[model samples]
Target chain A: MKVVLHIWRQSRPSTSQDFGQDGKMVRYELDDVSADMSFLEMLDILNERLTAKGEEPVAFDHDCREGICGTCSLMINGRPHGPERGTTACQLHMRSFQDGSEIWIEPWRAKSFPVLRDLVVDRGAFDRVVQAGAFISVNTGAAVDANAMPVPKADADKAFDAATCIGCGACVAACKNASAMLFAGAKVSHFLHLPQGQAERDRRVLNLVETMDKEGFGNCTNQYECEAACPKEIPVRVIADMNREYNRARIKS
Target chain B: MNWMLDYWRSSIGGKVTMAITGLLLFGFLVGHLAGNLLLLSGPEAMNEYAAFLKSKGALLWVVRCGLLAVFVLHVITGIRLARENRNARPIAYARPDTIQASLASRSMVFTGLSTLVFVVYHLLHFTVGVTNPEHFTMETSAGGHNVYGMVTASFSVVGIALAYVAFQVVLFFHLAHGVQSLAHTLGLHHERFTPMIKTASVGVAALITGGNIFLVLSVLLGIVEVQS
Candidate 1:
């Protein structure tokens, strides 16, 4: 299959960059490219070719390639992860494209996640947000039995849905406003759903939203672009949940 | 002021106001698009439509005033809500890297302000006949009725035409956020309909912006010449 790859290449984060300027559209013609090969694996072949030619390999981050890790992020053409719903970049297959298709691959362009080298971004901001307490503060001395807590099925389902966030940062990349409310809301709602987390529910929403704001993430304009771009399909309802929780906390304070 | 704050915070009044005003703007966009579509019929059609608007006298003024009130209320309530959200988190997050969001969502306030400026300029240039010099060319038709000649004349100027295009682009961004937010404010942001709303809003904004840009560019390029 012949594929014209328009890949974004950057030497360093400090260097001024443009889509196809600092980045070049490298063309590749290959035979017997498997449809089942993951997008990263396909990239592996491209990198191999570059390495053989004594050229710098295209630098993209992928750890697991199993879609569990959110590292393999790319804006394929105008859509994220090649227009597949509920899937990461690593899970996207070559079958999604025709043989003669022109693929435009670029790193996530958000102010918060500045490019470190090439496709690799400093996603440490997500880690810092989580460290700000995206969990219940519970002691391990007396572990409560699962049956003892007795969470309702509905609340548990909601919590599980919130917990499904893989911290990919795709929501931020997709949103026109660059708002992290969906991500922050997911984190806040995950904890707010259970009795164990109820103790810190108010504090959690307040702290997380404050943290999100301080980190320079934009406010949710309810455009739901985050949800649309989300690989996990996280609902914007979680944002409303966060808003409700924040309002409650404000009153209590 | 305290009462105002309470009203803004206590009930769903703030949310309802945001939704209602947003929907009004939405309605205005439809009317504006309809009015602007007269451009496709050539300058005479557009001008005649504009003159008709002027002849409405007090009724036109009443509609303008109503639109002004809606716009003011929407912007004010939106600002207040954003401020309240900000105040909810006075302290900075200790860990800043845990969440990854977008620039559009982050710079909404800035984009919104730019759009506001564009809106005022738009009204002054076209509606109030205060900004664009060409807008003064409007005159009565042979039937002793005032007809719209100013709009086509205004579009003839390269600077005004370019400004209109730029402002329309800003308007697209504003609508992209505003329309979807309106749905959320009204509690209609279910998963099934949310995407439809977002896509529809973007499409509508694109159409409006594209149509206006095309009209201005056609006029500026002499593709569509205005009548004497």
Candidate 2:
């Protein structure tokens, strides 16, 4: 099968042109495609061709293509990871596309995560947000017995739901205003649910929120775009929970 | 105290004010809508209702002052938050494939501003009688302002009634999203109750707008009258 992909190409950040002015779309025609081939495999084929012609291959972040690492980030066809819901780009197969379709592929677009090259964005902003929120100080010792601390079944399950967030930054990419509230909410809720995460609750919420704002991410407008694009299917309800946490912190010290 | 101030100053802090202020204004809407519905009963009852409010002069003024304060705060916070949101994303998407946000969610500013404009226009047209001076400034036989006479006269005009109803469309959309978003801000989420909340928001928007429109159209079409 054959398909045409309009890939965003940026040699550098400063050299800009066109709408969304960060990058230009460079068209690539691939004649040999297998429906069974994964999307990243197709990209691998393209990179091989580009390298053969001595042209610079597109730069994208990906590792653990099995989808656990949350590294494979691509805004394929005006979406965070193609059209399918709860699926990452690496997991998306060529079978999703029609033979002659012109697919527009771009990077995760955000001021916080600027394009370093082609599709590779500096997602260190996410790390900083996580660092701001994650503050668990416990003495180093042998692991405690599972029965040492008793947690309700509901809380345990909810914590696990939030704990699954792999920090993909898809919520940021999918949002029109690029709000990071969903990402922040997941982290905040993970701590809120556990007995271990209770000591610095107020500071954690305040610091993470302040850090998120400083990172230049937009405020959540209850759009639920982030939840929709999230490969892990993180619920938007976590955001509402985060809002409560922030307010409680404010009413306190 | 510093922490509290900083909390309010945060972007989410500003949203907290927005939610509270919006709910306060919606409370006022219920009272305002109830009072206006008196137009259906003719001049005497409506004028009496107006006098009842005027009788509580000091309390009325206090409520009005509070209303004005909240209104101004809502506008300021909304504008500031909107500007910050815009600043957060300096670059526009070439083809932003929006998935879940509703049309009302995206158009809050435009609709909100239009609602604000209508509010001013409405006050001038009825309260101060500046917009439709001849029809708006009627005097009651009891030596009080003829509130019902003024209201009926203004709504009798086809152009004025239509213009007012058009603003109700803006109000409907604004209230619909505003009410729902307020629930989210307050951390009130129950999957079973969300549909109920959404229905109630729409119902409130409809009831208020529908009540106002019905009163105006009744006067215009002679279903209600200025006469006893």
Candidate 3:
């Protein structure tokens, strides 16, 4: 199928190379593209054409096309990763688009993740946030018997639900204010639900929120756009839980 | 105010403050709309309404103080939340671009700050009689003569009227988030009622903005004359 591609292109990161200023929407014409091909795979075809013509290939980030990696991030058209809910760029198929539709594709826009080359971003900030002890930090000794923990099924389910967050940075991309509360909440809530996590729950929420703030993400206005665009469908309720937990920690401190 | 100190210490406190102040502001909007609608009844009606409040003396003062406190808490908590949010993600993404936020949600902070400025200006111009000259005009009311004429005269100014309309629009956006957030903060948002709350917030914001615009226009257009 033939489609018009509006891609945001920048050669370098400088005041002169800013988006909308340095970026131009380059149009490409492709024929016989498979509808079943993933969105990133389609981009690869476009880049291949550009390279054949000795033109610079468009730079984008993608790995593990299975969508579990959460690295294949893009703002397809106006919605995140096309119009489908609970999906990533790599998971999105060409069949979602009309044959002749004009698709506007761009990278995630947030202050915390700056463009490295083209579509690639330094998501290491998220890793740093997690490293600031998003975990319980229990030493590995005799593996604690699973039955000894005796977590309720309800609590275990909630914790597992929160733990499903893959840290894709989609919540930040979807939020207009660039708020990371949804992402931070998932990380915070995942640990707070179990007894093993109880030991560091207070410190975890505090340190993570503090780190998130230090990272320059915007505040959650409770808009729920983050949830709407989250490929994992992590609910904003986790954010409320995070808020309640943070308040409790603040009082204890 | 000190009791509110505990509320400011945590996210829940912030959430509670957001909810309580949000509900108070909602109530204030209803009352404000009711008062402004008196303009549709002619100058005497509006003036009598204002005069009735003045006659309450200490009671009016108490109500005014309460509203002021609510407004202050709401703004302070909002600012604190925004600041903490900014702190959470200090790094800029390499290709960070957003295409999902609604205008109302995205402009919340901007609209909020603008509305704050408008609120102060409004109080100074009409309530405090600092910037508005017509606020000094006197007129006869049910209890006696008072400053009803001044309000009509003040509303007649195109500059003031336009400013009020613009501010009211900002207030609309603020309320959009405030009303919805209030429900979440209070744990009133559930699967069955979340959509209802969002719709209600939108309707309330529209009604408040619409009501204020009507009063401002009626006064400026001379549709209602102030009784002397």
Candidate 4:
């Protein structure tokens, strides 16, 4: 199959002012793309071709290529990943595109996730938000018995559902406001549903949310774009749960 | 006391503020619509209803003040949040697209501001009687501000009636997105209940729009008229 790609190309900016302004779209025509190839594999082919031609290869982040790592990030054709729901850019196959299609690819757009290079933005804001409180502080000792603290089946399911979040910025990317509420909400709800997460409940909600705001993310307006673009299909209900948790924590404190 | 202030300053706090105020304003809308519906019963009923509200004196003033406070807070917080949201993404998408976001969901600021303008126009036209002083002076047999006379006189002007209809369209979009958002901010969500909540949201929008539009069209079409 043949496809034309318009890819965003830019070198890292020395100052914040030069971030998005320095990038431009560079077009590449690929005639030998295989329908079975993963999106990342297709990129690899493009890179090999660029390398042989003594041109700079496109810079994009990817690891494990299996969609679990949350490293492969791209805004393919204006969507967080691509046209498919519940799928990441790497998991998307070339077969999704029609022959002779023209594709537009760019890095995730957000002030917090500035483009470091072509098609690669810094998502360290997510790590900082997690570090704020998205964890338990249990002592490192012998493993505790799982059944000792019996959790309700419903709570366990909700917790497990939230725990699947891959820390990807797709929610931020897809959101009109670039809000991280869904991501931070999932983290908050993941802990709120279990006994292990009870100790830091109030503190976690306050810290995680405050940190998210400090990182220059926008507030959620209940548009649900984040839920739709989420590669793991995290529900917007987690966000409502997070709101409940935040209000509860505020009142208690 | 300090915690309350702190809560108001946070992001979630901002949304909570908007949600609470929005709910109050929505309540006011329903009440206001119900009051206006008295116009269907004729000038006597509508004017008497207006006189009844005015009869409360101090209580009426208190309710008006409270409604004003809620309206001010809603607009202020909404504008501040929108500015921050715009700055959060300094760079715009080349080919911006939405997957599931409705036009109403995306254009809240525009629709909200349009409604705001319409609100001021409405207050000037009816409450202050500044827009049309001639019709504003229309008196009923009973001594009262003739709200029924004012509405009929205003709707008789085709331009004014059409403008009312257009603003109703804008208000409909704002209310549809806003009512559902209030539920989300208040943590009201369940898969089974969401369908109902959504239906109720759209239903409220449709009802308000339909009722208000019908009132204007009724006067324009002569279904209801000022008694000769």
Query: TM-score, each model?
Result: 0.62, 0.95, 0.78, 0.98
Q: For residues A50-147, what per-residue lDDT tens digits would candidate 3 score against the true structure?
A: 99999999888887888788887787775666678899889999999999888887666666776665566667778988988688777888987779
Isolated chain B TM-score per model: 0.82, 0.95, 0.89, 0.97
Cα lDDT tens digits, model 2, A1-253, are: 8999889888776212332464678899999899999899999999999999999998888899987889988998878988889888899999999998888888888788877778888789999998887658888899889989999999988887788898889999988678899899999888899999999999999899999988888877776889999999988878888999998887785
The predicted structure with the larger lDDT, 2 or 4, is: 4
Residue B124 of model 4 has an lDDT of: 91
**Superposition TM-score, candidate 1 onto the true structure:** 0.62
* DockQ comparison, 2 vs 3, better candidate: 2
Could you say which candidate leads in TM-score?
4
Can you list the residue pairs that collide in candidate 4?
none
Q: What is the interface RMSD of each candidate, in Å?
A: 10.8, 1.9, 5.3, 0.8
Clashing pairs in 2: none
Q: Between 2 and 3, whose lDDT is larger?
A: 2
Best by DockQ: 4
CA error at residue B200 for candidate 2, angstroms: 2.3
Of candidate 1 chain B, the 10-residue stretch with the lowest lDDT total is B90-99
Q: In model 2, what lDDT does residue A165 have?
A: 90
- Model 2 Cα displacement at A40 (Å)? 1.9
Q: Output candidate 2 Cα RMSD.
A: 2.3
